[model samples]
Target: MPHYFLDYQDSFHDLVDVDGRELDNDEHAATAARSMLAGRACLEILRGADAVISVRVRRGPTPLFSVTLAITEDRFHLNG
Candidate 1:
């Protein structure tokens, strides 16, 4: 199983597991999980904000196997 972390503005917000169906295989699962995690992270940041600035992916401890999702907001630009 793989773990995912959602960060907002460099702050931890939520964590979740990526569904197996969303991925092609265990390896891809990790990648999709990380991407979804990033989306979730960005959503968290834009939940109440007026606009999204940016979204980013941060490689975690398991860069080769694991990853982190980060979201950033600046003015009216959102990057992911």
Candidate 2:
């Protein structure tokens, strides 16, 4: 097992996981990041605002991977 830090950010907030988590591997960390990003994105969507959300995975001082979700409203694409 390895220690990983999952830093999360979005249109309105930036949070760092100082305590971090102990996981099996990088793959597990990535999966966790994606799940976290999706949950945050859903919350933003419910609030009726466009959002850009991401989770950055890091091992100690080294960044390993990032998962992101960007949502924007395109009024022109909507059929009125």
Candidate 3:
């Protein structure tokens, strides 16, 4: 198992994961990151904060993947 850090990134700064977790593979790490990003608590955060909040998937100091909740605005409606 390899250690993966799910770091939280905002516009101003990044909140590093001091105690990272050891996962089975990259897919597992990515799944965890997505879950953290799209959780119900995060939705509440999105409602209040204007800046985009993203999850940075990293192995040691190297980044593997990055994802965030994207809000699309149009005349008709929106999509995530």
Candidate 4:
């Protein structure tokens, strides 16, 4: 097993995972990051606001990869 740090960031918040999680492999860590990102995005949408959510996967002090989800509304819409 390997230890992975998942740091989450959004429009209004920055959460650093001081206590990293021990997972089976890199693939599992990536999946967890994506799931977290999706859950955050859903919460933002429920609040009726656009959001830019990202999860940075890191091993120790080195960044392995990152996943981001951007949600924006279209402002240019035809009037009914």
Score candidate 1 by lDDT: 0.42
Runs with alpha carbons beyond 4 Å of true place in candidate 2: 76-80
| Model 3 spans > 4 angstroms off | 11-13, 40-49, 71-80
Which residue pairs in model 4 clash with each other?
A: none
Give per-residue CA lDDT, model 2, range 1-80, as digits (tens): 89999999887779988999999999999999988888888888888778888999999989999988888866666678
* TM agreement with the true structure for every prediction: 0.33, 0.89, 0.71, 0.89
Clashes of each: 7, 0, 0, 0
| Per-residue lDDT over 1-80 for candidate 3, one digit per residue giving the tens place of the 0 to 100 score | 99999998666667999899999999999999989878733564556655576898999999999888654334565686
Q: Rate the local accuracy (lDDT) of all candidates.
A: 0.42, 0.90, 0.80, 0.91
lDDT, candidate 4, 1-80, per-residue tens: 89999999999989999999998988999999999998888888888778889999998888888999888876787899
How far in Å is the alpha carbon of 2 misplaced in model 1?
A: 14
Flag regions of model 4 displaced more than 4 Å: 75-80
